[model samples]
Target: MPIPACPVVHFELPYRDAARVSTFYQTVFGWQLQPMGPEMGNYILATTSTCDSSAPDALRGSINGGLFPLVPESPLQQPSVVLGVPDVREAMARVSAAGGQVLGEPMAIPGVGDYVVFVDPEGNRLSMLQPLMG
Candidate 1:
């Protein structure tokens, strides 16, 4: 059997000014911005399309994302896409085997899933997420 396909389920971008970026996207694209608390790194969740709470990925072709405060020292400060994987650990191994570098250990996102960043062979920054099952 062929390997399971991982889909781009989310996108993330860093922002210098939270209010400015939130207003821009909300006013221009009509995206609903939900500001998370400090416990969750103050990440701003952006809902670009309608979704079913019972099923996170139930709405095919529709993806949501988050906006994070930009940290100049971090390597993953640029815009990037997040691929949904069934197993983040396995994906990390695959990335390394394919000559890509896993940036760090997987981090748990409360109410979300395990997530880890990686760099592809061509140096593009990306992430893998193993979402929590209900």
Candidate 2:
């Protein structure tokens, strides 16, 4: 079979209270929430699966995710998925040609990569990320 063009590298959830949301995910799902400070936007990394000493090498389809504050005025305030792409600009163009509207210009996320969000024809919001290469 041919290779996949892109895969979902991560997922995210929105919250008002970082502590409460982190604690809730940890308590109910046994997930580990790693705190990130203001420079990273006070986000929380939710380790839902892993390939570490404690957990077995994760299978092909599983992924870890993060939680961030809900920006009340943002076009994508709801829970959204982040899709990995080779080029953010190209992806944005393809999304438009495919009937989706790119919400805004691509923004560079420190330590992450080029990122932009969009809304599909059905009104579902999602994001695309061109991860930084080490």
Candidate 3:
């Protein structure tokens, strides 16, 4: 059978030290890392494959993610996959019904759309994102 199209859109990981974690991945995997300023919460954009960062839509079967500062109080302080959903609110409800726990309420990213985190029944962390429509 063919693979389903609900591919993982992005991934994320937390780090106690952004520079150190960025360097580790860059050195080990040769992935490109772009550090965002304080306004973006010191997030590091990780480019895992050879896709062009300037035009992400050109890539196929590939994804990249960000490295965020670890927050002691946050449940999102673990590596997680961000699945693209058509509606984050609906996804949250579905997660709850499917024996998963939604971490918190969905929040709208400045230019992005709604995003929420969750933990599967087996306790693996994951996230859902509803991209901003054009």
Candidate 4:
């Protein structure tokens, strides 16, 4: 098999109070948030500008997921997802223009690059990251 040009690299969580969740992350770890896709119920995504303390300039990220209200049918926080992006800001703008929400602007992480979070039309949480130069 051949390597795909692009791949579905990560999966993330789904939350109901997207705004609240976004805020939670922003406060906890200083991440930015962006909303995506009203057709999917104000789905939001998130990203981080900071890198791991050990590796200040490293691009530290997991997968990306979504945030939507827990359906009475499905009750759970789901799993946290990590995502990858070449450029966090560009990805955010693209997502927002495509009907996604720009929940928060990019934030710096001291020695790390910049990051932002966002969601899709389906309410899946996602993150974007950019590494800072030495």
lDDT of 1 at 92: 95
For 1-134, candidate 2 gives per-residue lDDT tens digits of: 44348888888889999889988998998888998889889889888876434546665467788988898997668888899998889889889999999988999988989988889999988889999999
lDDT scores in order:
0.91, 0.85, 0.84, 0.60
Single out the weakest 10-residue window by summed lDDT for candidate 1: 51-60
Local error of candidate 2 at 10, Å?
Answer: 0.8
Query: Where's the lowest-lDDT run of ten residues in candidate 4?
Result: 1-10
Residue-level lDDT of model 3, residues 1-134, one tens digit each, is: 44224457889988898778988999998888999879888988888875554565555577989988999996647899999988778778778999999987988878978888899999999988889999
Q: Rank the candidates by TM-score, best first.
A: 1, 2, 3, 4
Candidate 3, overall lDDT? 0.84
- After superposition, the stretches of candidate 2 with alpha carbons farther than 4 Å from their true spots are 1-4, 51-60
Give a tens-digit lDDT track for model 4, residues 63-91: 34345556668433455444445567777
Give per-residue CA lDDT, model 1, range 10-117, as digits (tens).
Answer: 999999999999999999999999999788887999999876455765555788999999999977689999999999998998999999999989999878999999
Q: Which stretches of candidate 3 lie over 4 Å from their true place?
A: 1-5, 52-59
Question: Model 4 Cα RMSD, Å?
Answer: 11.3
